[model samples]
Target: MIVIGIDPGIARVGYGVIEKQERLIRPLCYGCIETSSHERTTSHRLHEIYTRIQVLFAEHSPDEIAVEELFFTKNVTSAIRVAEVRGVILLAAEERGVEVVEYTPNQIKLAVSGSGRAKKEQVQDMVRRLLKLEEIPRPDDAADGLAIALCHINTLR
Candidate 1:
């Protein structure tokens, strides 16, 4: 089965694609969709994310999409913007006929690192070890995407 994990945000939306067979998990691709502040409006940025995510779905044709649930944020404006971006992501998945699964940050950490309060670096390290990668995935957000996907895969087992 193929799974795509997402760490959604307005300025940067991270993604990772993985293939699972039996007990083996393989990373297919990992990256981020970024929008510059120079963009005209939040709507335009969201449009970009929506378009890119649709293209990704077309290319990967994932069986399921695993997304990180929104956590509490001190900044209300940022939280709202992230929520909007996440909505666009869900819409893209729905349009593509992909199943969507949401996992909270704590759930992800617990699944990935055996602890709900694992540090960022600790989680990243575990992702690297689990995937047998030479090094940690670049750009923290991309690693986070991989973590989310891996968390879901583990939960299923």
Candidate 2:
């Protein structure tokens, strides 16, 4: 099975693709979609994210999409923007005929690090170890994206 995980945000949307065959899971690709502050409108930034994610869906042909659900944020504006980004992501997945699964931040952390209250570094380290990567995936968001996917994969087992 091929799974694409998303860490949604307005300015930067992180994504990771992984392939699972039976008991094995391997990384395919991981990166982020970044929009400039000069985009001038929130809708435009969302459009950019949506368009790029659509391309990713077409290219990767993922069987499922695992997305991180929104947790509380102190900044209401940022939270709303991120929620909008997540909606765009779900729409893209629906268009591509991919089943979408959502997981909370604590769920991901527990699945990745065996601790719901694990620190970011602990989860990142676990992601690197589980994926057998030489280094932690660059950009914190990308690593978080991978963790989301890994969480889903572990849950399936």
Candidate 3:
């Protein structure tokens, strides 16, 4: 099975793809989709995100998508921006007829690091360890995407 996990953001939407066998899970790809502020408007940026995600769906043909649930933010503006990005991502998955699973930050840490209260560093380390990667995934958000995917995959076991 192939699963794509996402960490949504207006400027950089992070993604990680993983392949799962009966008892193995390995990273296939990981990166971020960047939309510059130079874009004409928020709608334009959103359009870019939507289209890029569609392309991703086409390229990966993932059986399922996993996205981190939006957590509470002190900055309402930041929260709204992330929400907009997330909306497009979910919509893309829906249109492609792919099932999506959502996991909270804590749930992801628990699954990836065996502790709901694990630190970000610990979770990132665990993500690298679990995937048997030589180093932690880059661009922070990409690692976040992996952690989110790991959470869902572990739950299925």
Candidate 4:
């Protein structure tokens, strides 16, 4: 099975693709789609996100998509912007007929690191180990995206 995992954000949305079979997981691709903070309009940024995600869906041809569920405390504005980006991602997946699954941060950490309260470094280390990478993906967003994918694959087991 091929899965695409997303860590949604307005300024920088991260995505990872993985292929799983017979208890093995392989990283296919991972990267962040960045939008400029200097943009004068939020709508343009959202449009860019939607268009880029649509292109990614086409390129990856994933069987399913897994996205991190929104979680916020003490920053309603940030949460709202993230949620907007997530909405575009979900819409793109739905339009393409891809199955979508949502996971929480704790759920992802637990599945990837064996603990719900695992540290970022721990999860990154485990992802690198599981995928046999030389180093963890950069900028944190990519790492989180990989974690989301790993969480889905682990849950299936």
Best by lDDT: 1
- Residue-level lDDT of model 2, residues 63-144, one tens digit each, is 8899999876699988898899999998988887789999999999999999999999999999999999999998998998
Mark the regions of model 1 whose C-alpha exceeds 4 Å error after superposition: none
Task: List the lowest-lDDT window of 10 residues for candidate 4.
Answer: 34-43
| TM-score of every prediction relative to native | 0.98, 0.97, 0.97, 0.98
Residue pairs with backbone atoms closer than 3 Å in model 3 (clashes): none
The TM-score obtained by model 3 is: 0.97
For model 2, give the 10-residue run with minimal summed lDDT: 36-45
lDDT, candidate 4, 37-152, per-residue tens: 79348899999999999999999899999999999989999999999999999899999999999999999999999999999999999989999999999878988898999899
Give the better candidate number (1 or 4) by lDDT.
1
3 against 4, candidate with superior lDDT: 4
- Writing each residue's lDDT as its tens digit, candidate 3 over 1-157 gives 9999899999999889999999989999998898888836889999999999999889989999999999876989889999999899989999999999999999999999999999999999999999999999988999998888888889888
Model 4 CA lDDT for position 82: 97
TM-score (C-alpha, index-matched) for candidate 1: 0.98
**Cα lDDT of model 1 overall?**
0.95
Off by over 4 Å in 3: none
Q: Per-residue lDDT tens digits of candidate 1, residues 1-157?
A: 9999999999999899999999889999999999987936999999999999999999999999999999866999999999999999999999988999999999999999999999999999999999999999989999999999999899999
